[model samples]
Target: MAGPGGWWGRKSTPAKVETYTRWSFYLIALSEPLVIGVTALGQVEARLALLFMVPVVGHVALALVLVSRALDWTAGRRPQPLGLLGAVGAATAVLAVTSLVLTQHGPDGEGAETVLGAVFGTTVTYGVGMMALAMKERRRVVWLVAGYGVGAGLVASALGVPAVAALSMAAFMTAASGFIAATSCFSVWLLNAVYALDEARETRARLAVAEERLRFGRDLHDVMGRNLAVIALKSELAVQLARRDRPEAVEQMIEVQRIAQESQREVREVVRGYRRADLEAELSGARGVLRAAGIDCEVSGETDGLPAEVQSALGWVVREATTNVLRHGDAKRCTVTVRRPEGRVVLTVRNDGATAPHGSSRAGGTGLAGLRERLSDVGGTLDAGEAGDGEFRLVAEVPLTARPALEVVS
Candidate 1:
């Protein structure tokens, strides 16, 4: 079995919100029986209290079922609970009529009237509120609440209640139900907003990856497109010349070979540039991307004097760490620090979210393994793992030494 907090800790932000909202409605449904049923027992005769308890308990049960189904419908997990919604509405009407009958003939005391009034108002308020959650439009929610309030008054007046008292009941029901309706609607809205934001964050990460791929593709095309066309034309001309036994055909073929060799070198340069990361640029980008994703990212380091190879390796570390923070965990804050301690330049990135394990494959990609390979090339070391207190930390260390710069082909 999982530990005490494991169940809750495993749930995502939106799932937590959904659970909280669903249980809030459940609590309201449960409170109906505890508040109204218990009040009925103490304030009225046993038989009459039982009469009131019957409908109150029944309504609470039906409300619980409807709340689940309605929320499921709202989340698109299931079809609309049209049948359940109608049943709950019918139960609410029955509860209201029962309360009115008891108030009219079953009792003649202040306590009895108070309990019956509580039953009538509370039932209608919660019932309307619960139904409002499944409604697609605010206008329908308004109409539903108004209709119930007006219906309450009409039912009271038809049962011979005083006109002024019936009007007061209508107003009370309308205002109370309106408050509950607004609360329910707001809860649903907040839950949806949370889910939408999480999805948008994922989309942003995907878009960033796509944009980087497009950049690489464009660079490759620019490097190879012209060279490949020239090589093809030269080869075709050489073929025609060689068939005519022209001496220039040998020269043209040699030129084509040189062009092909140059193309190969250029392609390697493009790949090298694409693979290499600038430490300063990566640091700045990591901060911006994390901050845009609602993470508080703090960078406290300089990359000015680092060797190119060391910087490139550490820069990959920063990029990968930032991506993990964005895609793997629910991190709130990230801290990146670079320190040169005598012989080694140490880069550390720590985040408050620790869901992703160290060296884990990321979305079918090499993940930390790729980072490890990059760091190894520069004679650096990488360490990534949970650092306790719900934090994940990645540390890369490269020796501070002069490294030969990559030679460019002339």
Candidate 2:
């Protein structure tokens, strides 16, 4: 019923009145076999003329409806792909029907039946093809819908589908349509779900980093604050006592200054560990810890000329290895080597011996996991275990040109 005036009166997106409008060609396409079957009962001489009456009634009504729907879609600015499907489907159905009617000599004849059947058969084939070629697996339900279409064509050809049989078949087809439509709609749903989850995860990650930064700042304040206050008080007391007890006060004041300077450096490096990796500071820290623990620490190889990324990652490896030696090794000494071989950076941390059960290795810990993740982003890696007789070692290699700070330090 949509005319020039009527088509202008609707809004778009979630298009209204598409149920009947989109399907009008389907009714035309469905009735092709019916008209041919009906013509089969008529006389040969007048059959063509009578068949013309069916086209004017059934075919023309069907075509007008489809065209009007296309116009409505265009006016409403329907999506290009859906609009294309509607246009193509309508055109194909019209062509198929026209060809069948023109090729027919008369009613009740073999040639006429063959032509009409082929027209419907081709449509069924196309529907099946679309379903088969659909990108998503669930969309294959279009096969069942296409099968139903073929069955409907067969039933309509007889011009005598019982009401009960027609209803049953229609119900089956509608169910299949639901499945196909659901498959299409699921893609949109999945995309939205993935997008929402990604945003949530990113938010959580940011929160975790913020929380860790806060914790680090608090720990630094607590540890260094008390130590610095003690050092300051000792220095003041030593200065007052220096006027009388010169020898004892001189030693105390020297000790106080040394302790205060070391503590201040430690605090600066701890702050850097939270926000950055400072190579020279980390190396100095490692040297201090191992040397204090009665282990002779040797740092060798050229470290001064390395890129920032290589230096930083190697610095982490040094930190973790020193931490391990302190916690587990009862070694006399540890040799730390940084080597650049064939344009790649390598770090080796070797301890003489460990005070632990024989023939066992710790599976992994957070420090190791953190190192691995950092290395992996830059196409680098860590390999750690016993490397020689009675010696434990950790080795890390990174590309000199790698940009881990840009890629991973986030």
Candidate 3:
């Protein structure tokens, strides 16, 4: 039931580029028969026109198949389409020869030469362009185009065309086919670049997550490692003393219990600090991260008098929203604003170039759900959805008066 607009909105940036490139080629292929074949029908006899149209239509169909397979191959979705490329090349040569024969021996009309020349030139140019998509090397594409030009000249000479006319045919084929070939090459390059950029963005987000995890792990180890070592040594000493029936064993055991309790409290503090995000630090971090990722990020906010709980809740919102902007949509600009109004702190993260549909639940994953839970604990609210004009906005509001008591996990 989705309309074209809805369907288009759902596609990612790379997907959209791929669709445009693919359909552009499809239109080019379809235009051949629609334009050139119709012209041929008007110039030639109906029966002869059908004869020429049959092969042209068949070539167009073949070109369509090649376009899909060639694009798929370029995208790494399929193996190189060597067989199809060969078949298309052969078909193009056959069509070119047939058109030349028609020009020389078939019905002589005012438009026959023009129509035949178009047939020959169009078939050769289309074939070379489609074949260019399968080629990864620019040198190979250059050679392919040059070779086709030479082949066109040689074929014309074999059909008794004059030397000058044959050279002219070669030049025309070279220029036309080279244009199409260059277009095909550029399309392939642009598509590949778009995909590479998308991959890099995803990789950067993953690396950011991974680096944070490593930091947290290092913090936990630094807090607990020496304390656990001390506990083990004290327990061993207590065990040895108790075997000798010594009163010092009780003292050592009590010391061991005290150290264990202290270690537990220290671990809890570390975990609490790890979970708590500072609004100022998060805003600074988001600005740097987004800008590093090529997004123009402007952050205007202050957390000077905000309570710790309010800062923590909104800080989490900023982190999650920034990550989504990098990983989900193709955001080019991000604006994060924090303001205190109506006895509440409002934090808004708005970004443009969002590819997600309007009113979608979330962009990437359940990060939004987890964020909502975190905000709810501090009496904060989270709102996120696509705004108009390819923008996404996330807003988190926490009352200044709401300061939920923090509990230390034992």
Candidate 4:
């Protein structure tokens, strides 16, 4: 359990979801203005059009900055941009409202309504931009957003635009409020979901590592525990016999030495066996490991009557393939098949979600190259490439015509 000192941790990034929401906000920023421009085409005076452009552009820049910072925060990046852009956007929104109010001739006319309509529409976009920054900063600023919304609504009302109407400037502003709520709240919810997923994945990886370590420790204890105990007891007995000056004491001592030597040899054999690769054992292990990693693995093969050399070579291939599947790709299903048709043993590992391996060339890292070398020693060939539709296939074929000399494993 974590201690009290570490109970409440700092906030983190939203990762995968940040990119999506940022792009969504970008689309909103791009489209909202175009929409308002179309709606106010004939009503706005030419002299005051440039004033409107400033706030729109400023608000978009501010929103982009917010989403970009949010992305950086989630990804654990450093040196984020300063937060002054939101302040600038807020000031620009004030200017826009002032300009719209000054230009209005009367409260109920088409020209007055159009300017107020554009002002109110973009005010909602500005509110969204502020809410985004608050979320990125992980601060309690909903009250600030609420206050800003009220202020914008009041500005609209001053020019004969109500906050709520069935088919007027008030209605569009009301929709803007809804838009702000949906985007802000949805982005937050999605961020939390993404964070939870990342946490679960990390937990799974840590558990797998811990389980492997425990298994190795248990195996070592089983292999050497009893042998060491027997050696200790025998040495004590031999010492007592030697103190009594009996000739049998020497024999006892010699027997103890022989037993110690045998135990040493046994330990070496045990360690070597633990390290050596066996095809059947590799297949079984691969299945268990893949299943533990939430991947469905189906293996089909006949292991009987195979040359030991071929099995060992193919075992390495299976081991390497399993590691790559777990570490490199986001695979969900893996199929391993072994066939001995036409006097040659063919082993194929096919898996979905295989990405192109990164590094020099496409043949993958040094591990596959080593496997290729091992296979070649037994008249075998290895081929690996994409099988289309996001599938990766690896095939290792070794001829059975020439029986390979058994290779000693140390």
Candidate 5:
């Protein structure tokens, strides 16, 4: 692994990055012998083989440096070019010197042949190894490999050892660069496509959720709207009939009860889809509960300035508070306030709900917990506790969105 201090290094990343890195190393590895080997092949007598060793050494050094860098990249490091090039030069020198000592000298005929083979084989390995380490872009440095291939091909050719075969190898190495570039380009495109597909999937999920909400809203409007209209009409009819004749009015009275009961049921069901209450609905529901419980209800201040999200949230608070008041506090009166002044939307529900019931206190339940979460989701909070002895007040405040209703409607 290359450390942060150095320029060229491998750092851990995706497989595609690694693949390109591997290919780059391959190019470097194959370049060395081809470069020096081909260029020196035409006349390999006297110091010719020694001359051949120069590029081979250069190639080996370059390969070592590149391999180190690729490893560094694999380990999540980026490399510096000058430092990387220096390392490559150093490695080629070592390998070239090693090859010179071991194989550059000719022993007798058989020994000369064995030494040459060893040198050539080692040279090839080092060349390939270096290319494998260099970054994909850096594999351009492996053009030196083509030199080796061409030289070897030419040596085999000039000596009548079959030059075409050697040059063909050169052609193959030369062609690889284009293949490498093409594959890298394709990988980048594939990555982008995957990201785009993920984004599309996410958008569809959001749309599905929204459609489900809209469908529920329609069903709620149908059920509640029709029942409320029928109940209102039947009540009116019962009133008129009561004035005209007692027996006939009594029959209308039964029908009114039936209609009222059905409307209430429908409202509760509609409420399940969304606790969809506006300012008016909450006030009306609160008023009825207070009247039924023989408590006085009072609300103050305009809520028109509040956003629909905030209004809907506060409406839940009002309902839960009112329910607690009647069922637990035995409240005689309750006051609710919704107002915006000084850049804040304020909501308060207060009652003598802090009083214990028959010398016992009641534990809060899901309604209150749910109201807290609801308010929090709208960037508000619920605070319910004793304002003083025998007095309970729940205060909630949220930022006001000026066009609250229109925002919700949209």
Candidate 6:
């Protein structure tokens, strides 16, 4: 996944910027030890240099082993805390013993640079140890760092080194140690935070898809539920009449076929996301459904010679309004009126016995919001609100132009 266009994907602008930052951290980690190693080698003979390298290599190896677990934790891998603890303890012990040995084996007349080089070698052990301790126990880590700096200063002072020099080294090492440790810990924590956010975003996307599926299921049930029931009733009647006269059975069977065909068309419309309404079909369906539900429904309209865009937009308004009347309120009467005046086509649906919408906002349901979006694209508008005492009204208007229809069709 490290290769090009793999897990990192095609490197974006942000990723390219981070490349320099990532390299800077690595260079600092590597150069700290190298600077100390090179400075020690220049000041000492080959024999002493070899001896010096032994403890430096050992301490750094142990520190690296200890910090590897923290790296693993950042990468969302298992943290071997027990092994990390062992490595940290071993590194600290080795660095302490090495510092005491360096003090005893004073560099040919106590050269300050050589002694400081040996002391600087302890940085890796202290830095990695501090990070481990900080992650586990904050208070204890502060005291541990303080004790390490003081102990190193005491060791240098006991070797009869200058008081001022020992104190300076102690302060310098302490600051350097804290800087490396804090940087490493913070970098890992930031990466982990980014990973968590990505997971949360993916989870939300999945939940949204699930919500859409549930919405589609509800709409399908609403559309086909009554139609299927009517088909069942008609088929039963057709079977009974077939036993007596064939012509009556034939008529009932034809009605069942028509209902089934309409249901299939409605299902297709819901699935394809191209659900433009037909004025005649919507008007016919709404009247039939409303009357069957025992509500006195009256529709007044001149739907002839209208542009396709106007018909599609207003047809959706009629259909949604009728659906709301059936599903939402307890109504005795509903009126649908369509008029074309002054180059505007207006369709109004108003009903008595209006109840509060099932949800908070009027456009909370997908149907109304979708209708509004559809209307907007075709230079049209929609408004739904309480009209008067115990009544709600929905009004939709569209420009009478063939341009919108062309745009919608294309």
lDDT by residue (7-39, candidate 6, tens digit) is 332232233334433554545545545765766
Residue-by-residue lDDT tens digits, candidate 2, 1-410: 85642242222212322333335434544555455455544434345545544533443444344444443443344332344444445554554445444443335666555545544444433333222212234444454455455555445434554567555645544454445445433533443354454456456546855998888979788868888888988888888888776688988878888887788777766755664565667778889867875789998887888777777777777776776675445568889888889879888888865332122244556777788777776668888766656577777899888875542211
Name the TM-score of candidate 5: 0.31
| lDDT of the structure predicted as candidate 4 | 0.66
Model 1: how far residue 142 lies from native, Å: 0.8
Which prediction has the highest lDDT against the true structure? 3
TM-score per candidate: 0.90, 0.33, 0.94, 0.71, 0.31, 0.54
Q: In candidate 1, residue 339 scores what lDDT?
A: 94
For candidate 1, write residues 281-304 as lDDT tens digits: 999999999998899999997778
lDDT tens string, model 5, 345-404? 788888864453221222445666687667767677667666776677878787665333
What do the candidate models score in CA lDDT, each in turn?
0.84, 0.57, 0.86, 0.66, 0.58, 0.66
Which is the leading candidate under TM-score?
3
Q: Comparing 1 and 5 by TM-score, which wins? A: 1
**lDDT comparison, 2 vs 4, better candidate:** 4
Estimate the TM-score for candidate 6.
Answer: 0.54
Query: 194, model 5: CA deviation in Å?
Result: 68
Poorest lDDT segment (10 consecutive residues) of candidate 3:
356-365
Expressed as tens digits, the lDDT of each residue in 1-410 for candidate 4 is 84532222111223325656767766765775676666667766655555556666666666666656655654457444445445644654675576457546535567656765575566565555544544444343454455445665666667665446313443454456556655666676677677676577667667966996787678778766877787788778878887887677787768778876777777666655544568998999999988987899999989888876778778889988887776556679999999999889999998884453333114656877887778877889988877878677889999876355343424
Compare candidates 3 and 5 on TM-score and give the better one: 3
Off by over 4 Å in 1: 45-51, 107-112, 354-366, 401-410
Over 4 Å off, model 6: 1-26, 65-68, 104-107, 116-126, 129-144, 150-171, 240-249, 274-410
State the lDDT at 25 in candidate 6: 53
